[model samples]
Target chain A: MELYIGGISQGKLTYVCNKKNISKDSDLICDGAGCTMEELLSKPFVNHFHLFIGRLLKEGGAIVTDGAIAPDGPKTDSDRHFLLKPGHAPDPEKIANVLAKDLIAENPSVVIICNEVGCGIVPVDRTDRLYRETVGRCLCRLAEYSQVVERIVCGLGMRLK
Target chain B: MIILITGGSGSGKSEYAENLAVKLGKRDLLYIATMIPRDGESMQRVARHQKRRKSEGFHTLECHTDLKRLPVHGFPTVLLECMSNLLANEMFSEEGIIKTRGNIPVVEEILEGIAYLDRLCEHVIIVSNEVFSDNGSPYAETAGYIKLLGEINCRIAGLASCVYEVVCGIPVCQKGSGIL
Candidate 1:
């Protein structure tokens, strides 16, 4: 896994495109927010890795299986996974662990674009704090599992690992 | 030359900035603290920082809100403690004073203040918290603060001779390779 991280609109996508010479038309590009692990794997390429955390939080802190797909949402798996934006989960750690394993099983490499979010002050709201920590922990897991990690600032890429 | 140092809370950016200030000084260095320790927690934070810098020979200047009219002294090296607090101070004034103004004027004031600081100090080492990266939605006003902080960070990165992101007690130079 190759992880590209930076703030929103900090040019992580542009940097990835230029570096890998990826053509958007040919490559399967999709926003990972509220997307499933299967949906993510279905696509060869992906960005907004931080949104995966959001999706996980939405899924009651777990990545629902193909059979256990969300009911209120579509079961076609066309592009649907979770519901909540940021909610208190049953067990976030278990969710993180399960998805982490699935992500490591991919045959080809995948580029995960994460938004950095742990540098600011702790939010007063409990839900906000949980979301921040969830994203932060997810990024740390991805970073450890990733072969290459880059932090982009102002459209420039810095190799972190 | 300008050096922009950033890090998360408890990431040791202050220590790194202080060391950089000491090394880059051509005259007595100025420590422009932007934080206003109104509450007890903040007051303790300030006291800890002061104790750390006590033997460093810095002439501290507590300029919380207004950086434009900073007493003009040709200090070769000056470290602005942080931009986040400074921005909050300028954005939301003291309680019961006046209605909190819009972000446009606050951003303008901050930009003007920074330019003035740039002119007064030869080597400006700016310290700022990384605010915009959080994943959750902030309050409407807080969201505005995040936007402005990002703009200022981008602008300053262009002007800075060096930029460092300190993480886990290490300084990672993001821009301007030399003179870290």
Candidate 2:
């Protein structure tokens, strides 16, 4: 696996296309913004991988913090009761690890392009904090599994690993 | 020598900076902390940093604002923990924003403070945040803070003999040498 990361609009996708000798609209590419998990696993290149995590979090996949399921909306008695269940709440870090494993297992040779989001000011919203934290952890795992990791700046790739 | 170290939150910039300081300095090492613990979260952060600095042979000094007025002086090597919180404290006064006082601007005041430390210390290792890369906030105050921090980082980098942007516990030298 290979990973390419940078800030928004730093031409990360363009750099990847040039490096891979492929076009932007090539069928080998998949956008995590709207692509399904199957498409992401099948494609050779995945862009906006952080957004996929964001979407999943919004869909109530893994927004857990402190071993408690953070409510995305109004909580009822059943929600409270569910919170009482032992060993049922999912951890964001564990979720990231599972996602990373899935990505590496299903698409071993995939190249990922994700935005650097954990650098900015701490978000006031709990979900935003969880999303960025989860994305950072996921990227860490992917980078560890990746053979080559580069940080993109102004259309230039700086090899980090 | 003025060294500016920058990286994102939880990117291990602090550990990198501390190690660099230990490598560069001879004996007297000063850690100037700028964050003011106003709540539990920030207090936890402060404690985490303190734990990391234990046995690192650093004499810490908490200077939340008015860095120019710091009394202690003459250290062989001085490490300022961060520039973002200091900049925010300077920029955002209780009355919204303080762009200028009399003639000196906020940036200049802060820079002057840095220059004071530079003049006094042999090696000044300044730690700053890489907060400019993310999707920016919609608030005007946030935009203003970002712009100011960008200016400060650029200025410091220009003066710095070494500038490092750390990522994933790895220090990537942006300018100068000796940090490899």
Candidate 3:
């Protein structure tokens, strides 16, 4: 497995395409924003891998968005860990761990392009918090299983492993 | 020697910094904690960090804001837990209002605090967050905070003898010969 990670719009996908000698519009590249789990496993490359984790969390009912935040919410830490529906949702962290294991077992040679999302301020919404934390855990597992890992910055790739 | 360590949360930056501090220090080790526990979650975080360094013989000083005024007893190595919390504490006062003078003063105050630590300690290890990467539509004040932190990190990196961005428990040296 190969992993490429960086901030949003840091040119990770472009760097990967150039290095792998793959066209930008190749059918083998699957976008995590819309692709299914089966497609992800079968595809050679996955972009926006963080979104995939969010989708998974949403599907698993770990993300509850209704009545969570006001349209323009008051920016305060009061809502930091306030669950919208307590004891009614599946644990996102466990789901994320299982998904990570599945991905490593199902597709060991896939190339992943994920945005680094855990660096920002802690989100007031519960869903956002779970999404970022799950993404971080998922990427850590993937990076460990990856044969090579690279961090892209300003369209430049820095080999990490 | 000033070493700036930065990374996303859960990237193992704290663990890496602690290991480096332990490796560099001889007898005296000081951990300057900047986070103010507001709730259970933050308190848990603080406890977790303390548990990690339980046997390291670290004398921790809780300096949330006004780092410049915090007195240090001059340790061999001083590890400032993080810059993000310290900056937040300075940017937002106890009443939750933004400081009137803007972020320049905050940056200067933090850098001055860092300089004080540098003068007092032989090795000043600083931990900061990589908060600039995430794509969040933040409010104006939040944006200002981000901008301020980015500037502070850059200035510290410039002055740092070594800088490392910890990724997945691995320290990727960005500048200077990091403690190998």
lDDT by residue for model 3 over A18-76, one digit each (tens)?
Answer: 99999989998999888877777779899999887776555442222332212122234
DockQ, prediction 2: 0.29
Candidate 1 iRMSD in angstroms:
7.1
Query: Model 1 - which docking category?
Result: incorrect
Off by over 4 Å in 2: A9-46, A56-60, A63-110, A118-126, A133-145, A153-156, B26-28, B93-104, B134-140
Q: Mind listing the fnat for each candidate?
A: 0.24, 0.35, 0.39
Span of 10 residues, lowest total lDDT, candidate 3 chain A: A62-71
The candidate maximizing TM-score is 3
Of the two candidates 2 and 3, the one with more favorable lDDT, higher being better, is 2
Task: List the DockQ of the predictions in order.
Answer: 0.12, 0.29, 0.29
Instruction: State the lDDT of candidate 2 residue by residue for B50-103, as single tens digits.
Output: 877777888899887788788657678989989998888777654212644544
* Predicted structure 3: lDDT: 0.78
Q: What is the alpha-carbon lDDT of model 2 when measured against the actual structure? A: 0.79
Q: Report clash pairs, candidate 1.
A: A49-A113, A117-B133
Best by lDDT: 2
Model 1, A23-108: lDDT tens per residue? 65444666676555666766756777667666555444343544233324454333233423333223333444455556667523
Each model's TM-score?
0.55, 0.72, 0.77
Candidate 1 displacement at residue A48 in angstroms:
22
lDDT, candidate 2, at A161: 91
lDDT of 3 by residue, B1-180 (tens): 899999886677898899999999956798999898875556656887898887888889988777767777668898998998888887786722146555366777789889988887799999999887666545987888889899999999999999999885568889997566
